[model samples]
Target chain A: MEAYEIVKLARDKKRPTAKAYTKELLTNIVELHGDRAFGDDKAVVGGIGELNGMPVTFIAVEKGGDLKERVYRSFGSPKPEGYRKALRLMKQAEKFKRPILCIVDTAGAYCGEDAEERGQGQAIAQNLYEMMDLKVPSISIIIGEGGSGGALGLSVSSKVYVLENAVYSVISPEACAGILWRDAKKADEAAESLCMTSEYMMKFHVADGVFKEDFSDFKGMCAEIKETLYNDFVQMKKEAPEEIIERRYEKFRNIGVFAEKKASSEKGDID
Target chain B: MLSLTELLKKSKNTIENGGRQFARDEKVKCPACGKEEYRNTIKENNMVCPFCEHHYKISARTRIRQVFDKDSFHELFDNIESADPLEFKGYKRRIEKARISSGEKEGVVCGTASLNKVKCAVFVMEPGFMMGSMGSALGEKVCRLFEYACENHLPVIGFTASGGARMQEGILSLMQMAKVSGAVKKHSNAGGLYICVLTNPTTGGVTASFAMLGDIIIAEPNAVVGFAGRRVIESTMKKSLPDDFQKSEFVLEHGFIDKIVDRRELSMTLGRILNLHREVI
Candidate 1:
């Protein structure tokens, strides 16, 4: 199958959501809620968890598994309150010397009138600014779809990862088709044009590594994420706070770094 | 509440007098009001309608000339031509049209300029260039400009006027949001100052990303700044929206915008900001 055909599978309605992955991967998970300023947004799930005895904070956009839950979660399109809640937790993590592991799975940030009225654009931009200076180290993993600013709100960190079958795009192919071709039905063609699959996303240097999926061995996949989390904790805990912040700065700074391809290859730019 | 027909009747009479289709003539009509003024009169007033004070969309080059110190702007990052990775339909043709009409190579133009010799990087998006979309080439230029500012310790000023990401570039255009935001983060962490001036109709991915990351965010008076366009939000939610839903005044009231400046005072205001920043440093 082509990349987007696989994207369909990765985005399967029955596929386990962020909540499922967190349940399997983290120990002693305790979800914290609310932006404190506004009421809580159900779309994002935020909490504290343990990985191999190491304390960590996990923030994720929840794409509920079933039709009913999907409506409840707004299909993982988080409103401004959700992003503010995540920022609130990220600051807490920094103050308490906890590493952050954010799971990005939203189709995009909420664009409803009330959401914009509450400052959705500013909220995401604030997250981007604050995440870079988060005193402690942080990592982000795209367990499913990393959609535009929705995914980015929680994913600007020291390291970023993605599941093997996950897809990330700036704008969804459906919207891109609708806007570009004036024919939303050409979404399949738009998907092919968008370099959204993990394999294609590799060229952008956005995600550090891909966690290979084993459908028959889902537990194995959980184990791998846990292992990576543990390893990051061990190494990141030693670095000085300033060094951690600086390294995180450099990590994000290095994205979109590209150079012209050699004369022997096709004449183009590659990251 | 008034019935829908009453509302339609009320608007139809007004729209006939001043709507865009009714405004085309040797003398341009102001959308904000029913007044008609000579085209030269509007342009002479820095493209602000004299009667209603509506700010008209200005070109990137014209904006640079209007804002910077006389003869002090040096253009950068204009050499890189946008490559069509997917061989997208009519992408090249769009590029050609933008180039011929606007004399700009891409959607965004980046360079160094002086606000009274207090150096800063300026990025102005040309609305004519496919509504100043963020394709890979534009993204790379913006990222590089941010890095340049960081390396040189110069403050940055950005003028955003875009419809959002370039659909022709697909995901590549979208990824620019993260890339540019990352660049902004680095510049900010390095103690560099950045100001973003939001212009008319700044929407979509552009509004969601670096456009909002400025240390001091300013907007043109009455500009429309939001994540989703008006039509999308209305259709998706299946309801009419507030008149001020995406307008700059609403954003200012809601706390995203620091201030709104009139077109005539923008340059002086920027110079004042740059001077104040220097004193603090």
Candidate 2:
């Protein structure tokens, strides 16, 4: 089957979406689950895999297409346990010196009352912080909808790629339009204005690249991804461990700089 | 009855325009100085009264220009657009109208710039842009911007003025709280500094996340900063409100915020703090 056809097939499946994709895309895949602080979350799935015989860690959000499956996977939205599991896997991957490849497709983090009771925010935050300093190369691909913190929890990477039709944003377009105009029908306009598409993200430097939709040739697509992954890994490996850590640190520190004049006045210094 | 209806409509207009009428009316004198001039208040002392030192509200653009180094700021996430994932009713047209009117890509303007030679990443939320709501695109940009900063090893400074999470996005909007907070924690743990400057009307989910997670939290004098509004809390809890409920000073007193610095001194304070954190450099 073609790569696009396989993705379509996986998308249509009711159970084991991540497993299906992994079986097709990877050679030797091993499943790793659980955060260790708590129980494992099935919504987030991670493991070690071989792409063209090169070892890599694969993490992806698992969404159930059917009602039963969705309930089983928590509708692709992870709870605290899910994030913890991802973090554990990420740390393990770093220890093994293998590159990490994350596939983001969740609508957002699980916002159930139960999730909050377990300190969902803290769990997600911990993962994000840990992922930034991981010594291994990391890449994140938005295969579908990358929504909110749930997506971000798995999305800290040196090279981020988005599928042609995938959407990534802070809040969904419908929500913004609804809140601003008291109308949800304006969501298309909101989407256009928001630039949630991969094409737009590539322009803004949010996405390093956009994968071509022509997955009719599954082997070619796989080879291209492998090449891109290798190049990114080679470049990342060139930097010293400390340099890599510092570079990741700086990547987040330099957001949103603007112009302002220095002020002369000041209240008395605080004691 | 007719006059009352007309008065109600006028008042609604005033509210819609974000309390601009108080500045226009000659009878509405400055509470601090008894001055009839409102423009004077806006101009003579950088959105503060020269005579009485009363701090006035500053616009997002004004705040950005005042704090960032001259011509050192470059806008990012200005064009990565938004999409309505739900295709909710009338959401598409309304966003178009907002884009046409606000002349902004979204509620927040994110970029990189130098503050008094101390380079930092900045995000300024414009109340004018859909009340500075956090939607998918806005949330993505904020997260990506932090990622960019983390990669570059620069500190992040945010001037926040949000009405809260955009309700239209439903659960997705609320998720930004965790998303951005996660980013902030990542940036901080990497030895990067995060300074959040809370402006007027910073409330809702935003207050719950990165807005309150700053290593050093600063608010403009008298800015409304809280998780929930005074009226809603009063109604829900059925209790009398305190004199300074949710006000900047009140939050400072309670340790929810570090200090209530006047806007004019914001840039210098931030610069000094960033310089102190220069060990990373």
**For each candidate, what TM-score against the reference?**
0.89, 0.55
**Runs off by more than 4 Å, candidate 2:** A1-17, A214-220, A246-271, B1-209, B212-281
Q: Which stretches of candidate 1 lie over 4 Å from their true place?
A: A240-243, A257-268, B1-26, B31-34
| Cα-lDDT of candidate 1 | 0.82
Residue A224 CA displacement from its true place in model 2, Å: 3.1
Best by DockQ: 1
Q: What TM-score results for chain B in every one of the models?
A: 0.88, 0.84
- What TM-score quantifies how close candidate 1 is to the native fold? 0.89
Q: What lDDT score is found at residue A245 in candidate 1?
A: 77
> Candidate 1, after superposition: displacement of residue A27 in Å?
0.7
Residue pairs clashing, model 1: none
DockQ of each: 0.39, 0.05
lDDT for position A170 in model 2: 61
Compared with the true structure, what per-residue lDDT tens digits does model 2 show for residues A1-271?
Answer: 3322332332444323444455556788888878887788889988988876878889889886678978899878888788888888888888888888888888777754345446454465556567767888888887777776677778767677887766776666666666566687876666655556665565445577987644466557656766777688778878777677667655433322121222453211111
